[model samples]
Target: MKIYSLSKIAIVLSVLLIFILLGALWRVSAVPQTSLIVQDEQFFEVKPGANMTSVLRELAEKEVIEPSFWQSVWIKSNPKLANIQQGWYQLSIGMTLLNFVQKLHVGHVVEHKITLVEGFTVWQWLEQMAATGDIIIDVSYDHDAFEYQFTPLSKHHQMTIREGYFAPDTYAYAHQAKASDILFAAYAKQRQQLKALMSEFTLPKFIHNEHELLTLASIVEKETGTAKERPIIAGVFLSRLAKNMRLQTDPTIIYGIGPSFNGDITYADLRAKTPYNTYRINGLTPTPIANPSLASIKAVLAPEQTDALYFVARGDGTHEFSKTLAAHNKAVKKYQLTKP
Candidate 1:
């Protein structure tokens, strides 16, 4: 009887231990796995001063992570999680709980992008930067302060930051980046691009320095609608410069008029004298009229060897080039005057 009682007690104890082990295993498996979440990707922000409970609640609300008894127990056990840094985070589906916590703790935030287009004016670029909701813009357009910011990049002693000084491209930054920081990056990129191009190609005789090259390039960019015509247009401008003839370019006349220009360039506007009016000025404009692409800059540096000194826009996206005034006039009559 004593042996039977002892055997019964041992059997009961063994069964109790087995049940306890099974419960422990179930709890471990219930902790959230990456595959358990339905969302493929999520962008979340933890505001400054948000506590751990609030963050977990917000995550649960977004359906990024589910709230359960096991998750709550996990959070309570890991007290260090409450100190997770606040910022934007991109979470992928199937991310393990451990990995997710690690990312938040390390403050691995998502980067945002902004693009500055080629041929845009400085004012236009500023407008686009201001439109980006995430950036903090403190730069004012009222004075020459912004121009002086780029003094380090200019080779000319008198040259300040001009319209074509910033490289046009997409740039990525962290959340709440300052506008000045973005502008400086663009300026640095443009300087680097110019340096690289100068090293690769021999500059034309008419382009004495970086300032002249950028000024002519901006005009070339505005004059040519097609990519292939950039070199030809550049050649025409260089030819005019060599012959001491007035550029007489319409874009320069319009630029001189500023906001008052109502889209129409009249004979009077051409006759009017302004710093940007190439029609009246004997040489290139005092500064770049607009930002030029790297290709346009390259075209100006090494223009195609051609005798063509004139071109007329055909009203189609292309232009007709001519070596003499008579041919140019005839082409203009056919393409411009005869257009129905």
Candidate 2:
């Protein structure tokens, strides 16, 4: 009878112990494990091959997650949690521990952004990419990779890195994003943008194909500052092209001179026989001088119909368009020669 009584007591104690453990797990799981107050956002990286234990320890050390023995127990209970992906992660306030672990396991990481501005040269674009602190710029990678990657965009197989094929816009990427990834994104976006724009407008008589249209658009972009003036300036270039007149645009001369070009263009520079020198070469430059915006590209396809062939800057970030050389010379004297 004493033995029976002892067995009953032992059974009751075992049941009570199981209930106590279940209550503890429920309490820990419901309580907030982190009190991170994300203002803008929080960024962190998990190195390749980082295991869950080390990762959780680092997160606790950083105060991203509250350190708790129960939390470790919960995480270790699942064998699938072992496959944590390595990359940057953006964490925010009010995220549950369960949600965070799931995101890490699936490799959902934070994305970084870099903006490539309109009218930026290829070199300028590279500099912008390097300026973004998040990306890993591959110094040894050849910049000419664009040639093979975007062969159809080039007029010939000899397309150099200087060709303005990359579309100018803001781009987002994950951490450790390479320079090629950014460039290729820009290029791909530009191709899509150009293709869409092409379908919307009939190709102007002067623009024979996509390559020529982009070349003209780049010139129009460099020549004008005002967005409203793009179509008008495109008209002047088209008119010049129609009449077989020398483009006489100074930007082309500056482009030909390349890095050696000082702030100013000289008379000798105009006469210099470079492929990009519009004064020496009759048609468009061998390639685009800078990446043209979508608006500029659109303007080239649908130019403002006008007989005006000349424009002089009005010094107030505008230009005075004229129909004849005589009128052009007069405007140049007023705007250029009489500048204070």
TM-scores for every predicted model: 0.71, 0.76
Report the poorest 10 consecutive residues by lDDT, candidate 1. Answer: 148-157
Local error of candidate 1 at residue 305 (angstroms): 1.2
Tens digits of per-residue lDDT, candidate 1, 83-201, equal: 68888877786677767777777888878999888887766776787787777664544232324333332323243455678788899987776666777798899899989987898
lDDT of 2: 0.79
Provide the lDDT at 303 for model 2. 88
Q: What pairs collide in candidate 2?
A: none
Instruction: Give candidates' CA RMSD values in order.
Output: 6.2, 5.3
